[model samples]
Target: MPTLFSKYAYYFNQLCEFSPNRLQAQKAKNVAPVRYPTPVQKNMNLMVDFKVENKVIGYSLASKQHAHGNCLVHFQSTINRILKPDSFVVPRETVAISICNSFFTLGSSPTDFVKTKQGGKPLPEDSYFTYKMVTKHVMIVLYNSEGAEEQLAGFVYYPQLLTSRRVCPNIDETAMALARITYSSDNGPEMFARFCKKTQRDVIVKIMNGGMSATHMDYNYILLEQNYGSCSECNAFHQEKMKKEKKEKKKSITEKAASKSKSKSEAATATETANSTVTPPPKTAPPKAVDSDDEYDFGN
Candidate 1:
């Protein structure tokens, strides 16, 4: 049996062969390789072949050098012919290949990977969290053999991470409170209903506005539930955030020095003002000389 690594490598090589430049080069030499509508391969017991539909999809080239061409291949597993169809499970290799195919089909750029929109918000740039989330979703879709569009349709308005009922436990209560406070007329009941709905929508939008970062935490929580190990992505994100916070919070040496100098100058000015405001004791100079002469005459 071919190892998972071998399978990925095989598919990647197959994709490269279908590159437009390579095809054109072959044609120019009058030695074009045979092409198949569905490329199939056989495996021994407990094995199933994947029939991949290959095509070249046009995308904005990330660089001028890539203007030559790019290939997009979609792999569909045909498990109907598996020796043990009832017991067979889709391999992780299939999921990995699907991700790779989707990536290349879109474009070879960070922006291409970020085109997916979650909760009406465009996904941020690629990261470990995003990569794992994408992989998990793809795995689910493949395992169920469901249309990716149907499985991902919910994410159009809300993220999969927030699918649980408990994520926003107070949403209804908060909406109700807002509605009651805003509408206190004779048609209060009807107005309350409308207001509540609007409030709920607004809350969801607000959550999604900050959802990207929150979702990272949620993803890690889910992973923790499954196993005791900590998420490396979450750890790395936290460490990076700490680094940024420290940098922002730290005072520069120049600022400290300036503050010290200002304080010293103010102290000196205060001391001078205090000294000038005081009255020295009145002079007793002439009285002392006269008192000595007067005391001598009285004694005589």
Candidate 2:
């Protein structure tokens, strides 16, 4: 029989063997470390909150080239959200649903939370969230080729809010009041000013406007999502578009060649007609009469 320590060690090794993060970590060893410049805004020196749940998992830096690709707010959570390679294949939407079920709940299971929309106004069924909620909350966007809109990937929740709810009996009522106020208002600068300070407002605005301008910076990185390269619909559309473009190009070339050939035939015919119409100058009548005029041709 194996010792207790040995058994645990074996289990740990087995888990590491299937760990995606472990593989990434090994890859990182060979790659150079990337450093990001500290961002400063307004009176507040804005920095990524590395402390989550009061535990330091990893440093959160402002990197445009992180794994998630240009995430405005990246929290390096200790937990790995990726599924194991050997585990049964799971759809991304299914994974999103599982995360929702584990972390949040409504009065019931809220199993359809992944498919359901949360907002006051009517919207397309595929929309992930209300525009207002997105402006106010920290959220992640996930997408696949088939979905009409990007799906809700993940969300961060503050444990402090839960603690406050547990301690403060009237927290629900206060929350309801806030919710009513939020719903009544629009997602504008004024609304954001009420909830956030100047720096937060500016950062969120830039993010909502599709990332701040980093063009002036020399070493900025390009961000891309994991599934950015795996869009079947996009691939098919590109194929069809290319085929149409190629056919048009061939048709244009053939038309040009035919036009040139026709022009050459027309030019030959014109040259032949012009040559045939030309008549040599009538031969000059000899000046026989003039020669005799100088002599004794006083003519009778």
Which candidate gets the maximum lDDT versus the true structure? Answer: 2
Compared with the true structure, the alpha-carbon lDDT of candidate 2 equals 0.28
lDDT for each residue of candidate 1 in 212-256, tens digit (9 for 90 to 100): 321121111211111122334443444565567567657566678
Best by TM-score: 2
Candidate 2 local lDDT, residue 120: 57
Worst 10 residues of 2 by lDDT: 214-223
Q: For model 2, how does the per-residue alpha-carbon lDDT over 96-149 read when each residue is reduced to its tens digit? A: 111231222222211112333346544454433321112111112222223453
What are the clashing pairs of model 1?
none
The CA lDDT at 143 in model 1 is: 10
Superposition error at 188 for model 1 (Å)? 50
lDDT for model 1 = 0.27
